[model samples]
Target chain A: MQEKNANQVRSRNEIFAERTSTKIYLEQASDDNPYIASAAVCHGYGVNEVMAKKSFADVFYLLFRGELPTPDEVQILQQLMIALINPGPRHPATRAAMNAGIGKTDPAHILPIGAALLGGEHQGGGIVDEAMRFLRKQQTTDAATSAAAHLESSTPIPGFGAYYGGIDILANKHAAQLAQLPGAGKALQWGMQMSRALEAQGVGWLMPGVAAAVLSDLGFQPRAGVCLYQLMGAPGVVAHGLEVANKPITAMPFVADEQYFIER
Target chain B: MPEKTFSDQQIIDSLNARRGKIISKTGGWFPGKGVFSHGYSMMDDLVGKKSYFQIVILNATGKMASAEFAHWVEVGYSCLSWPDPRIWCNQIGALAGGVRTSAIAATAMGVLATDSRTYGVYPLKEGVQFIQAALVNHQQGLSAEQIVASVPSRGGKPLIVGYIRPIAKGDERIRAMASIAEGYGFPMGPHLALAMAIERVLQEKYDEGMNVNGYVSAVMADHGFSPDEVYQIFTTLVASGVTACYLDTYHQPLDSFLPLRCDDIEYQGTAKRAVPTAE
Candidate 1:
C-alpha cells in the first residue's frame, strides 16, 4: 500500500523560505532558445562551423571567458594546464581519495573527495588564486618595497614562500615559459621580482604562485584560474583512487584500531 | 547450492531491511563497488555505449524507455530548457555566475533550487500522487467524477496546479508537446488516459488548459513511472538547460541579465519603528 496521501506527501516537501517572491527562470527579452534547436550555436558560431574549422582550445576559451582567446593566449593556457595538471599523489586531497579508495569505495565517490579538498584555502588552486590576487595588488610597486612589506606582514603570503621551504623547479621552469607571453603586465613583472626577493630570504617560489601570475596576466580572475587547478589535479587523484580501490579490502587497518576511547 | 523457498512478505521484508542513499540492498542487491545499478553493469555495458537520453530512461526505469516516450522526454526538455537565466531554478545558475563561481557550482545550486514544492520537482511529486490517488479510486470502481471530487480532501486540486498560466488562451508549449506525442503514434496507456480525462473535466468546468507540469505528468504516467520515479527522473532531465544558462552567462557582468535597484521596490509597512532602549 502507498504510505502517504497527496497532501501528506506535499506537506513534507515545503521548504519554509523566510521571504517570498515570484520566481524567475528566464528573461523574456534577452536570453531564450525559442522552439526547437537542433544544433547548438555558441556566441554566433555554430557547433559544426566551429568543429570543422576551429580547435577545442578556442571553444574552451570562448566558454570560460566569453570570447575566444588570442592564439598566443590559447597556447599559453594550454601549456599552463599541462604544466600544473598534477603535483603527484602526495598532495593531501589525492592521499584522502586514495585512502577512501582503499576501502573499495567507488571512484565516483572517491574522486569528489579530492576535488573538494583542492577547493580549500591552501591546497589545489586556492594557494595559486591567493598568489595571483596578492601579485595583482602588488603590481604597481617595485620588487624591494613590495617584498619587504609583504614579508613583514603576519598573514601568510601563500604563493611566494613554500610551506616546507624549497625551490620548486617545476614551477620555475613553466614560469619562464609563460613569462615570455607578449602581454606580460605589471602583475607578472612584479611577481618575478617578489619571487627573487623572497628566495633570497630563504623562501622559494611554488608552482601555484608562478601559475597564478601567468593566468592573471592572461586575464583570468583568481577563482577562475583556481578552477583550472581543480580540473588539472583531478586525474592524478582519480588514478591513485582507482589504484587503491583495486586493492583487497582486508589489507588496510581497521578504523576501530585508530579510535581512542577516553575514560571520564 | 540448496534450493530455498520464502513467502512473498518475507522476501519483501528482507529486500527493504536497509534503506540507504544508493538503495544498496533494498529491492535488489546493488553491488556498488563497480558499475552498480539496480541489476545491470552501468559502466561496462551502458556508459559510452548508449545515447545519453537512453541512459537516463534506462537507469530511471530499469529498462529501455519506449521510443515514443523518449521523444516526448526530449521534446519536454527542449521546451523547458528555455534559456532565460532569471527563472526560479535557472536563477541558481545566474547567481552562481554572478559570484564568479564555476559552471559546476551553478549546476549544484540549480539542482538545489529544484528541491522545492512550489516550483521544483516536488510539484511533480504532488501531481503524480494526485493522479495515483485518483487511479486507486478508479481501480476500486469509483466514477471519474467521484475520483475528481475526492481529490480536494487529499490536498490535491481538481485541476493540477502548474507553472505557466494563460488568461485566455492555451499554453503553446502544451499544444506543441501534445502534437509531438501524437506524432509518436504510441498509445497514451491507462494511467495517462485517466489524467487526460481529468484534464478534459477540468477544461469543461474551468476553461483552463493543461499546464507544462500537468501535461508532462500525464505523459510520464503513460510511461508507467511511479510518483517517486517521476520526480527523480524529472530532476535529472531539466538541468541540461539550466547548466547551459550558467555557461552562457559565465563572463557577463552581474547587472547584465536582470537589473533591479532599491528604488524599484515599494514599501507597504510602517515607515519606521524605534527599538526600545536598553535599560
Candidate 2:
C-alpha cells in the first residue's frame, strides 16, 4: 500500500514587502494619472537637475552609492568608465556578439547573447567578485607577501595573474596610469605593490584586476563588481557585433574539411 | 617581451594544434547523408520509432532509456509544469509577455531563470548528491537519525537541500509520483528506503518532511542515474509552465499583469537635495 502523504499543501506565508521599495529612485505621480510618473528623483537630486549640474559618472555613482561623489571620485570614475568602455574585438563576449550579428540574428539579441557569454569565469565578469574580495582582504596585509604566497601555491592570485604566458602590458600600463590619479585609494595602491611583486613571476594586472581595485577603492560591493564589469564591457561587444552585422556568413573563416578532426 | 619568468610554450603548442579545427566525439550531421547522435542514426532509428523523452535521455546521457522509464520521466515533467505566474520562473515569462517580447525569447529567458540555485534545476544536483551520500553512510552502518544529525541545522531543524521545500512545509508531488511508481511496479530501492528513513526521522523530530526533489533524486540514483545526468534530463522542467504563463499575459492588455501605481514603490532613499557641479 502506498503511504498517504500526511502533510497538507500550505503556503509558508513568508511576509513579502507590501510595496516594492527602493533607496535609489523615487517617482512622483503625475497630476492626471496616479500611475504616471511626472518627475524622477535619483538618491535625492531631481533627474533633470542632475543632468544639468553633474556628469554621467557623478549620476552613475549617485545612483549606486546614494551620494554624490567627490571631485577626485568623479574624475577617477569618469576615467575608469572611459578605460572600461570596451573589452575589445578579440574578447569572447564581443566575438559572440559579432557572430550573432554576422549570422543576421535579431539585432535585439546581440547584447544579451554577448552579455551572457561575458558572465564566464575566464577574463570575464565571473572573476570580478573574487577580484574585489581578494583586493579587500589582501589590502590590509603586505602585498609582496600575499603575491609570493599565491605564487608558491601555484594559483593565479585573484585579479593578479599571468595572461598568455606573460604579464598583460596594457593592463599594467592602465594600472600605472590609474594609480597616478589623486583618487587612488588603499586598494589600488596595494594592487600596484602586488603588481610589482608579481613582475618577476610574469604575473600582473588583468583587466578585471584593474577594474576590481578601482571599484573596491570607489566603495562598490564585491557582487556589484560582476555586473559592473559586464555593463561596462557591453558597449564594445555591441559595437563590434554590429560592425559585421551586414557581412556574409563567409566573412568569418570556416574550417576546411582537412582542418576538421574527429577524435573518436 | 619582458624577461620571461613563466614558460607556457607547452600550453601554446596544445592550443595551436587545435586552431581552426573542429574535433567532436559526439555525432554531427553529414549534409549529403544523415544526422547522427550517440552513434544512432537519427532519421532511420529514432524519429518515428522512439518517443521524444527517450531521445531527450539519449542526448543527455548517451544511453537510450526504456520506453517505460521514459514515460515515467515524462510524467515527472508534469509534476513541475504548474502554470501559476506567482512562481519565480513563470513570473519571468509573465514579465516578458507583458513587455510584448517574442515567444521564443520569453520562453528562453524563463528557462534561463530556472538555473537559480535556490529553487530550480541546479538544486537537483545537490539533492541527488546528498541522498546518494546518505545511502553510502547508511551502508557503512549509520542510522537514519545519525544521518539527519550529521547535516548542519538551523533553529534545531536539519538544513538538507532535498528534504525541505521553499514555499510549503511538505510536498504533495511526492505522493502523486509514488502512486505512479507503485502502479508501474517499480521496486523500492535502497537509496529511496534511506531517504524515507531520513524523512521519518525528520518528520518525527522536527515536523519536516521530504520534498519532491528528495524523492526524485533518490529514485533516479537507484535507477543508475548520476546527479549530472538527472540535472541534464530535467534542464527544461518548467518550460511548459513558463510558456503557459507567457501566453496568459501575452493575450491580456499590455502592462496589466499586476500593474503598479506611482506610490506603489515606497521610496527609502535620501531626502531631496541640490546636485553639486562636477569639478
lDDT measured at residue A141 in model 1 versus the true structure, 0 to 100: 71
Worst 10 residues of 1 chain A by lDDT: A1-10
Instruction: Provide the global lDDT of candidate 1 against the true structure.
Output: 0.63
DockQ of prediction 1: 0.01
For model 2 chain A, the run of ten residues with the poorest summed lDDT: A1-10
The sequence of per-residue lDDT tens digits that candidate 2 reaches over residues B12-56 is 787788888878776777666677788888999999999999999
Native-referenced TM-scores of chain A, all candidate models: 0.75, 0.96
**Model 1: which docking level applies?**
incorrect
- Model 2 misplacement above 4 A: A1-4, B1-7, B277-279
Q: Chain A in model 2: its TM-score?
A: 0.96
- TM, every model: 0.44, 0.93
Chain B TM, per prediction:
0.72, 0.94
CA error at residue A91 for candidate 2, angstroms: 1.8
The residue pairs that clash in candidate 1, if any, are A24-B86, A24-B87, A24-B88, A25-B86, A25-B87, A26-B84, A26-B87
Angstrom error of the Cα, residue A64, model 2: value is 1.4
Q: Please give the distance, in angstroms, between residue A23's alpha carbon in candidate 2 and its true position after superposition.
A: 0.9
Q: Cα lDDT for residue A68, model 1?
A: 58
